[model samples]
Target: MASGSKWTYSQNKRFEDVLAEYAEDTPDRWHNVARAVGGGMTAEEAKWRYELLVKDVELIESGRVPFPKYGTPPGEAAAAKAAARTGRRG
Candidate 1:
């Protein structure tokens, strides 16, 4: 709960949940998000975190950042592996 401490996984998840509960136009949204996020997070910190999250989403949506390929299909994975071995683009 120290100032400038990094948010833990649980804290981030809770922040996302609480943020979803409060709309952008909601009164005192950042205050409510901060209180729900707990860990002594202030409204300013919550707003800052929200801004960072928005930027991250924008970057991902713009395709400047590659999306994670967690559930790639088996055939696609095999093809990519073969392409790599043959020094070819998939």
Candidate 2:
């Protein structure tokens, strides 16, 4: 389990610390991930599972998603595409 408060950035740090051990053990589903981490853990907690981290890493490496605001950056991609359609710029 992660150290400190659930919402802290340090939680991510702790998650990273465990990434290697769990790297090859990513679960396909959130429930599986939670179970792997520990049964009775919530799906929300599964967000920190090594699988999600690997997925995020793949997103970065593939350039399928950008790096700001966790990649998509709230409405940014849609807004940019919309601007392009309207013949405008941000």
lDDT of each: 0.83, 0.60
Q: Candidate 1: minimum summed lDDT over ten consecutive residues — where?
A: 1-10
Clashing residue pairs for model 2: none
- Winning candidate number (TM-score): 1
lDDT per residue (tens digit) for residues 1-90 in model 2:
542235445445544555444544566454554554453565576655545667888998899988746455446889999999999999
| Candidate 1 C-alpha lDDT tens digits along 1-90 | 654677665666688999999999999999998888887889998998889889988988999988745555567889999999999995
TM-score of each: 0.68, 0.39
Model 1, runs deviating above 4 Å: 2-4, 68-90
- Residue 74 alpha-carbon offset, candidate 1, angstroms: 25
Question: What lDDT is obtained when candidate 2 is compared to the true structure?
Answer: 0.60
